[model samples]
Target chain A: MIGATRHYEIDIDKVDHMSKQLTEEEKSQIYDDIKEFLSEELDVPADQITPQSKIIDDLNGDSMIYLELVEMFKKRFDVNVEVRLIGQYFQRHPIYTVGETAQAVYDIVERGDNLLADEDKASV
Target chain B: MDQGIELVELSALTAPGVEIALIDIERHPHLEDAADQFLEPDERARFVTLRSPHRRREWLAARVCAKLLAARKGLIAGPHEARIAQDRSGRPALVDPAGRAVTGITDCSLSHKGRFACACLGRPPIARVGIDIETVSPRLRSLRDAFVNPSDAMEFHVDTDADLALLWSLKEAYSKAIGAGLHIGLKNITSNRNPATNSLRVRTLAGRVAHARHVVYSNCVVAVCFIAQ
Candidate 1:
């Protein structure tokens, strides 16, 4: 599960603007890691996925599958990915290419990691 | 209130043979303080039940729903006899006791707002059922889009406040009725009023679930969903 966060470091601009609340590099790493993890988990070829792979249409991912992917990311990254965020992204943007997904992943990771880290440091 | 009752009766179409029970948790005494005894032994073993007042309300609501279901059907009921479990996203469900495969699917939904809690129960022979109720609050101004689809947004053109609340209730009810994770994405489903059919069409990318027979009582909006046998 932590494989995604460990795999690649992401760039800031690849993230969705509305979710640009976190660091660019952390987001980029998470995005690359998730795509790698997903490609492996889904048994789809790795090269088939890019920074913009559409989760549903291209990878043939379903809602439940996306959720499982998110859970794995959370397990790996130790971040709280609200279920509502998935809906927000799917509703707001249904882009299914790997590049698109990678971008989305970057946004989520950066925003998510920062929030988790802040909350963690605060509690300490 | 009369319209609300009619809506409830219509939503009752979800379960044909199974008995239905409705209870207001606010009416039950000591409900707000029974968190300890309310937990199932299994849950107690796992140490998941928290002592928060909100959890107490949820437990009380679950217990009350189970008890009412048992009483109405004349079945033996025990503490947590309904056998509740949550989906991956923590949505609640009641296990069917019939063991007959057909009898163990107890359909239910719970909603709480302010000091009140409400639940709806149905079973197979009865398709799927979900119900949601929420108190009207001014705070909803910021949460309207969180509840409705683009189509339903039209019907809400007038009383935006109540409309938003109703849509929110429908979203909860749909989630419960489907008994799936919130991943289904409330946006996937669209709601629209058909003036010709006088029924609310609740649709997803494919087809429709139950109709949104609207019912409101007090300061709450109650939406029920059910498929007829």
Candidate 2:
């Protein structure tokens, strides 16, 4: 059932940019980890996780899971993504699939430090 | 009153036939142990797999509260005699000792927030019922646009965090009552306030209407919904 539902198109440009920062092997490994995590968290079969599966509609997940996923990305990638920024991003662009979530995690890992610093400065 | 739903305290709803149980998750230091006594084998397995302590506590509290309510309603001999299972849409249903769906015989809904869990039970003919409790917080304001319907946003004026929390809880209660949850988006559920009675008339996009009653306790807003008979 994975990759069965397609609502939004993947940003190939962003994917290409992410590819430069992380190796193809690393990306595949990250995707595998995400699929495993979600499968276990949602109690769904791993085979059902597709790049196009709707996180809420298909996976039976909620906003809290999205926030947790962002935190997981930060810890797994050793980056500093602001929780508030990730929350706002999810609100604006509700993630639907494993692929979209992976892309969002990759983008955050690539620019997390700068974003966290900017958020800190803005607070001051 | 909107649809004749009288707002009352959780305690007030407790009567001979109707059973309501409220559990303070924080007060029970050994809720995990108590919860185990109530959960069936399948429920226990699921409970073991919960990664978050908070989630586990809430799950346990809700199940325990449900079991207590079921016992009080005489649907089961004890907590272990009943099993709570979710349908395809993830709505919890009561299974009798004979392993038959008892939802037709009894109606139950569970809601929890922070350290509080509430379970409300009604007999047959009250097939659809929902209860939700949410802590009053500023976060409700930020998530308002995502859930509050435009019609409700304009008709039901929310001036403070408490008001927003009540509105969100009302929507959640209604959704759970309909057994659709958020599948029926919060924005799809409309609310019309009856200030004179301090209640609201809520309608779902699916054309189901329910009367919601709420009360505030310990910084939390609790709402319950029942389909008009």
- Best DockQ among the predictions, by candidate number: 1
Model 2 CA deviation exceeding 4 Å by range: A1-124, B1-9, B12-18, B195-198
Model 2's number of clashes is 2
* Best candidate, TM-score: 2
How many residue-pair clashes does candidate 1 contain?
Answer: 20
For candidate 1, please provide the TM-score of chain A on its own.
0.55
Best by lDDT: 2
- lDDT of candidate 1 at residue A18, scale 0 to 100: 34
> Candidate 2's chain A scores what TM-score?
0.70
Show model 1 residue runs off by greater than 4 Å.
A1-85, A88-124, B1-22, B32-39, B43-48, B75-81, B96-106, B194-197
Over the stretch B1-229, how does candidate 2's per-residue lDDT look in tens digits? 0112112237643433345667887778677765656778898888876644676787777888877767655677777778888875567877876678664345678887777888877665565778888888775554555566667657666767887888888888887888764445566777787889766778876678886777788999888777634
Tell how far residue B116 is off in model 1, in angstroms. Answer: 2.2
User: Tens digit of lDDT per residue, candidate 1, span B36-77?
Assistant: 444455544433333334445554555455544543454434
